[model samples]
Target chain A: MKFTYQINGAEHTLTLEKHPEGYRAHLGTAIYDVKLLHAKDGQLHFQLDETRHTAHLAHETPAKRWLHNAGRTLVIEKAATHRRGADTAGGSGRLTAPMPGQVRAVLVAVGNEVTAGQPLLLMEAMKMEIRIAAPHAGCITALHATEGGSVNKDDLLIEVEEIPT
Target chain B: MPQFDRVLIANRGEIAVRLIRACRELGLSPVAVYSEPDADALHVRLADGAVCLGPAAARESYLDMNKVIDAARQTGAQAIHPGYGFLSENAEFARRIINAGLVFIGPPPEAIEAMGDKAAARTRMQSSGVPVVPGAQDLADDTKIQQAAATIGYPLLIKAAAGGGGKGMRIVHSAADLLEGAAAARREALHAFGDDRLILEKYLTDARHIEIQILADQHGQTLHLFERECSVQRRHQKVIEEAPSPLVDESLRAKMGAAAVAAAKTVGYTNAGTVEFIVDPVTRDFYFLEMNTRLQVEHPITEAISGLDLVHWQFRIAAGEALPFQQADLTPRGHAIECRLYAEDPANGFLPATGTLLKFSTPPGPGIRVDSGVESGSVISPHYDPLLAKIIVHAADRTAALQRMQTTLQDTLALGLTTNLDFLQAILAHPVFVAGEATTHFIDQHLPNWQPAPDIPAAAIIAAALAELHSPSATTHTTASPSQDPHSPWLRLTGFRMGGGE
Candidate 1:
């Protein structure tokens, strides 16, 4: 059987074949003998060639995998056709939440004039407060985040249409 | 003084768990207060009794003084331990706790008031014959600020009078930036700390953040438990802390230790507190930075080296006990280092990450201590501090301790969210850190463009592929088969997959 995996934005194909002792897998161009040492409770303890590795799968979300070995973690996910980027990338002049957090305060309102680098809102996450600033001098056209509202990463918070001097 | 048979911990997270363990060790009952979101928290589960304060917001729960006091009263707890943040440094909270006939396991309210304000603490330190950074008292007006700036010269700092953790702090390189810097500092201070007052100090560019851990009792006995160098920081928040700074010699340690004791004595400080200092690496001269009037997040290293239980001492002191050991009797035996594991994404400017901790495994061994309130299935809420745990390792020397820390960090696994664990490993392996040449500007000087781990092992990739194939949705697909036929040439694999969802 041939399997495809996406890791850190790169994809590779693994071809698995049955063996008398164990299983042989050809990952990309390299071939290795794979041994399943232990597997239970979302944990995978396996051996590839001479090296051993442990991978944990989330109980609820099985498509995501946390692979641990050699003092490093590789988070792999099933490749999706569409990728999510910062929502403000299309020259919309909109500010988006940099990470998941709660809006501590919405300092600016719709139609409020703001200067470049002026703080427009305060967001709190992980017990730290981050100030959201205007990317450029503009008037606020829309505000999507309210005080105490929870926001996710890449969620649009405010739209600022730059004013031509 | 009353006997503290049961202590109410008016805090949450790792520190609360730490206090609960200490209370249990000392044969005292621990009463934990939790917010609505933390009803199933590890600390609540570990405590002898638990009380629901309010919602997830700190203002409505942990910081709510009345509710905390009422919980203590209802639980019949004789003492209250305000761990680290939250209401730890609030003087009014101490006053209320003491007035309500409960022992506050911290410094006196007078001491808290004097040291709580950074500007006032500097004044007190200077008056007590401690060397402070060249600066002026609180600058109330523009003229006063300008005058102070002239004396202090350019390359000065505008700091919030009642601030810590880098909040309301600004640097001015020239006269042109002084007013704006001071204004912004005042505004931020007002918003973050509720005090708009500002202070000016001659900023030292190349300095090391060295702090002394001091324990005082009611009988005027104060002693230093040695020093911890916490120069490795980002945005003025410490991430890596260790005991016995590489720069401090016996003479310098004695000098700084005496100064820390004097500062504590001047403020009538009691219980466990830290006196922070900024030491110039070249001149070896030290100046008083400020005094933290409560348990610090990095206190574990001090405990690891000195073999002392700081929380136990706080409880003993608050219960009207004297210092058990004199200054000369205590000495650090080994070296210890602590890495703060935070739920943050190093690839994304260290932004906080929130989620249900789908997988959390702690490395266990001798000389390794993990103080954590989080576990498998724990929730990493944005409503509180991102600190998930403190991974502390003690060894015979710095070299061994560093090696142990690297290994322990590798074994420490946390999934389902972004974390600073790998970033911490990178720091531990950095050449500068290995050479013990790190200063206050260490992180900025090195690893400024810290990216996430670059390479993925082939084994990991293969395992991820297998897990994906074994997933429920993938099993239902047309091509992939979930189960294996042993008699045939196919071998089946069973493992759980991590689903990246909210």
Candidate 2:
């Protein structure tokens, strides 16, 4: 089916395909290996695996595109896609690293106003200094890291409440 | 030689797996050693047999000399090959292995001890007319030290007697910073190498870190396997090493090779080892940096260029074999580059980070060889080097190899932990690195600070966005919307899914 679409502020026609497994989408001339997990109201969450990583793409029906590849072909319908259980995530404690690095300077003052991308702390992982930007605009209700700290994969940095801006 | 049929590797991670490959190719029975953390490591599965070495702490396992020797003895092994770092260069350990009547598979104890002492090696090289660096006499008083530095030149280096890595090294431009720099060097030296004694030398900026690999036998025949450029470093530790350096031409290669041979012969060097040199780019002149009497991390580039296996050569030479490939017959054919894929965040100051491999996948194509120590499910704990793999690319020229590396880096992906992926991408993208204008200060001179590219690749954004939601252990986001849209949310959600509030 052809649908009038606007992504990244560009108007285009997208071809949506229904397959034996999931929906195949060809949007903006690029093939999207898109997988839908849970669709509630106007929100549709999907996963995208291009080459190496399988990305869970949160695709809102009335979506916003941050970028559009110039002179690039999109074949979302032709891209290989798969569906994984949305409930597959069976655990808790969702603290993610602000960025990849060794925790050098974690300025977690317990509770603080951490706007989305707020500079929560600093880390030196690959001989470079990078400020740990807050994942979302939130009130940091809990601080997980300390100054002069060492954190491993998925180790907590800080806990923030996702209060609407 | 005390002989055994099988040898158990007393380490986990990459070097252990590398050793297992060497052992299997050499027709020796291989045994895997694991910590509680590495029972699922790639090395354990690859080995013919596996034994739990001990807990995850290296000091209790890999660095535990007694435990290592005991594992070797218990597994009925003839020798222990300390593959570089963790106890590979330790002289005391080598001596103990010798006293235990087990082959060390490296240079003699005397060579390790001699090179271990930077003072003695400098003295020996100087005596042998190896064109030693001009430095102060050992440990002069404050005034005498100033006088010595003044005599040497305005910009002189106060290098630690036990220095190998960039630690314990101080560059004094004038007499003003002499005392403080000296004290700092001494403290770092004492901490790193147990020896606070330092010698002075001229500090040459814009130098290339090139080194020649030498294989000397007990029969007095020593040959060079060409050189590798390793100037790309962070915190004095070499992060990337490449062979047939883009800087050195044929004539320069010969001169550097000869000097390396001379340095090795001066100390009666043998086995698979590297003689490091700090080479001036403009003058094409070089100086002896130090000797690493063990396998280098980037030996694959050497192996690719020379078409000779240094590790196999090591075993053969240790097993009373002569240098199989003559120096005259060996010549580098192509330009090769190796980027060490460390488990650190380059956005940060390259501090080491540890994590379990969630989704480890490499770029698949030609002209690329990945020397990986861990796999998709391996755990990279804080107990060892954060280097997960060495992504090596070979091509007809340096440009092709570099392009291949950039493509490979873009294509590769790892979930669950952060890495220096973007940092490496930035370095390779630099005009200087592309122009083959690499130096010891390449990182400093070019990228003193990290900046996020305004235009990140479409693939990366998509991957990051997709990763935010799809990654195995990620929290399910209700919507990928403007309010909670863009890929960074998936990144943010990675935290929320785990319920990591406290």
The alpha-carbon lDDT assigned to residue B264 of candidate 1 equals: 93
DockQ of each: 0.12, 0.05
Poorest stretch of ten by lDDT in candidate 2 chain B = B474-483
Please report the candidate that would top lDDT against the real structure: 1
lDDT (10s digit) by residue, model 2, range B352-416: 87755544567678889888887754667887789898888988878788888888877675544
Clashing pairs in 1: A57-B498, A58-B497, A58-B498, A61-B499, A62-B497, A64-B498
Local distance difference test, each candidate: 0.82, 0.68
Model 1 error, position A101 (Å): 33
Q: What is the DockQ of candidate 1?
A: 0.12
Q: After superposition, how far is residue B421 of candidate 2 from its true place, in Å?
A: 1.6
lDDT tens per residue, model 1, A36-126? 7766556667788888777665532323556565667666654432212334353447778889997765555443467899877777777
- Residue B23 Cα positional deviation in candidate 2, in Å, after optimal superposition: 1.3
Docking class of 1: incorrect
What value does the lDDT take at residue B307 in candidate 1?
A: 91
User: Over the stretch B242-319, how does candidate 1's per-residue lDDT look in tens digits?
Assistant: 998888888999999999999999988899999999999999999999999999999999999899999989998988
